[model samples]
Target: MTRKILLLSVSAGAGHVRAAEAIRASAALSGEALEVRHLDVMDYVPAGFRKLYADTYLKLVAKLPALWGYLYQSSHEAKPDSTTEKIRRSVERLSTRPLRKEIAAFAPDAIVCTHFLPAEMLDRMLRQGDLACPVWVQVTDFDLHRMWVHEHMRGYFAANEEVAFRMRAAGIPATNIHVTGIPIMPVFGEMLERQICAAEYGLDPARTTVLLMGGGAGMGSLDTVAQSLLQIGGDFQLIVLAGRNVAALEALQTLAAQHPGRLVALGFTDKVERLMSCADLVITKPGGLSTSECLAKGLPMILNAPIPGQEERNADYLLEQGVALKACDAVTLEYRVRLLLENPAKLADMRNKARALGRPDAGKQVLKTVLGQ
Candidate 1:
């Protein structure tokens, strides 16, 4: 029988959506007789509520990150019967009506969720006899948070075995969990000539190239990072990816114009693999997909300011694994860059660690496990 798979993701961050897309892309390349569909789980919500949810989240993260951190920590430790969990369950139940309606229309054979919101909703639905298909939850973070826990989920996918061990310790059955790493598209792991990539991107091959990124939504003080790079006394070039943020792109373009031949500014483009292939290091926020892509490329990372919650945890994970350096400020960033630039040995060590951690075949592993192939 031909199986249908519905991949659900939320747009709160780009990683979840990108993970879903990667899974779909991987499925397409598998030559399987499977029907795959991707859905933005948030699209099922009413527009007004969706806008309010997104705006409030961005505002809180921007203006009051400490509060977000407190809430994130508090929620992570919430018990099944805790007030936070109850409240979250109530909200998810109400918000998922449209999702239920869409599910009725699509009637997929199996469901895969990259974000916790939809995963929790579907879990609840299954318990209530609203859903009958198998539910696969692919966590997009390196660290496991309490919100992802659900008694009814059939499968759980983690970025690494440490996360899987945590899941096992949390009372989830060991057989239900798989350490597949995060599902990133395989293109990131492709071997390409660095000089050719540099030439194609108009970057100088002789210079130490740094790729500055803030994920797909472009959320960071990237222009300041670019200006700080100028302070580091080195022969280097910067390729700044100001992903969907037009204002950031414009500001960075102006900065690049001021420092001719030293910086290249770009908006969101599909050519990230080629760019990362040509760069020696990446300075960016440690979102799950971006970090996985960096690891797949065997590139060293300097984590700039991360968001207060999951990203902070992801940064810590990368640092603990010796694949990345965390820079809390412009001075620290400059020092880290100078350290890597001056000591090729350290740079190579970090790159080797990243290579060891890379899971370029993660998407395939995930699909195989989910499909029981």
Candidate 2:
């Protein structure tokens, strides 16, 4: 019999959606008798509510980071039945009526939630006896937020043993937690040829290459960082990926023209694995998905200004693992890059640590666990 699986995510951040996509791709490659459907919970909600659910988060993180950080901390500390949490949960339940309807219509054999919103809703349903199938949750970040904890989940997939430990501390049973690492696209597991990837990107395979990414929306100070990197004295090149940020792409292109063959600017390409193949180091925001991809590629990283909440925690874990360095500004970024450039052994050590921590088959492991295969 073909079992149906529903993969749910909320797109307040790209990492959640991408994690769901990775699991779906894994299901396809598993060759099991399975049917999988991935959905963004926002798509089923009303436009007004959808904007509030997704846009409000983006605005908070991008504009009022301090306030966002405060809220993140406060929410985590707040009791589950606190008035504020109760009101927020009520609003979410009322707004996600359409999503509930969709879930009922699908009637999946099992459900996997990559983001907390759907998982929270599903938890309520299971507790109320409105949902019959088992639901699993995947924590996309290294840190375990309070929002991800629920009493009714069949299992929880964690990015590391530390995250699993956190889950167990949160009162989850030991058997229900699995340290599967974060799910990234299977392509990151492949060992692409560096020379081929470099040729495709018109980069020198012999030169020290640094790849820069600003998350999926390109929400960082890429221009300033690129300029700072250019000032460093080194025999290296830069590949800047301005994801879905056209203005940033154009700005990078203009700057690339100033230093032809030394800098390459691109916008939202799916071939990030190939770029990683040709690079010695990555300068990027420490989003869970991007960091997981870098780890899978065994690429060392200089993490830039991470968003104040989960991203900050992600940076902390990478630094502790000796896989990355965190930079606060353009000056610091330049210094970190220069320090790594001047110390080949240090850079190599970081790369080795990254490879040791990499779970390239995490997606496959997720599938196997969920399917009991």
Candidate 3:
């Protein structure tokens, strides 16, 4: 009999959702044995609670960024038995009931959760002896957070060797932690011909193409990066993704008007893989999903100022792996980007390093766990 496989994920920043989609696509491809679905589980949470949580997150990270940084640092310093963890557990107790109800209603043979919320809910239900099937949690961040670890999970799919190591340090059984890189949609992992893709995108084959990304929310220092890149005068074209920030997109549109064909501004796009494939160098903030996507494309990364917490750790991991370079300031970023553009050897080295670090088969392997194989 074909098993119903439901991939559960929240839509906080598009990372978890991206992973879930990737998993669903692969699970669907294994013939008649798997019927797969991907859903935004947060939609089941009370609308008010969801909005408040998302809004507060945006406000804290955008308006009071230092406070957000402080909290992120504090989480690192927090012991397993911290006060925050106590309150977190209490909230988990209350919030998991709806999730439990949904799982019972759906009655899926296996459940794959990409975010901590669904993982916690499944863990809680299983601990209470109410779970009905196998549950696997795919950790999106390169650094594993305590929120991602809970008793009763069947397995954990991790992004890298470091994340697997961190999961073991967090006391998860090493045998249960699978080192699959962050699951990205198959497009990022596709064997696209780079020269053809670049030409189709109206980009130059002989020159370096740099992809400048704001994060999922399209949030970053775009104007500064754009200005800096333009100042460097490299034989390159810049493709900047402004995401959903209308104001940010409009601002870049205005600036691109001054630079002519050197800059191309895009709003929220489904063509990320297309852009990534065409680019030789990518400059962006170090969000885990974006980093993973760049790694999949085998493009060298020049990291701008990374947000605290997971993104900072991702930047450090990639830098340590020789897959990426970090720019301390905009001027330094421009200088490094220009120098790399001028030298094909350094670019080739980084490209090779990035490709070697990526697990292109991660999405495929994660779906195997989804099938209980």
TM-score per model over all chains: 0.96, 0.99, 0.93
What are the per-residue Cα lDDT tens digits for candidate 1 across 158-179?
Answer: 9998899989988899999999
Rank ordering of all candidates by lDDT, starting from the highest: 2, 1, 3
Best by TM-score: 2
Q: For model 1, which pairs clash?
A: none
| Per-residue lDDT value at 255 in model 1 | 94
Candidate 2 regions off by >4 Å?
none
lDDT of 1 at 312: 98
lDDT tens digits by residue: candidate 2, 1-373: 9999999999998999999999999999999999999999999888998898799998888888888888888888999988889999998999899899999999899999999999999999999999999999999999999999999999999999999999999999999999999999999999899999999999999999999998888887687778778888978999999999999999999999999989999999999999999999999888899999999999999999777889899999999999999988777888899999999999999999999999988889988988887
Model 3, 59-131: lDDT tens digits are: 7766776787788777656775888777866765565567667678878988889988788777767888887
Q: Which has the better lDDT: candidate 1, or candidate 3? A: 1
What candidate 1 gets wrong by more than 4 Å, as runs, is none
Q: Lowest-scoring 10 consecutive residues by lDDT in candidate 3?
A: 88-97
* Candidate 1 weakest lDDT stretch, 10 residues: 48-57
Per-residue error at 141 for model 3, in Å? 1.4
Query: How many backbone clashes can be found in candidate 2?
Result: 0
* TM-score: the better of candidates 1 and 2: 2
Better of 1 and 2 by lDDT: 2
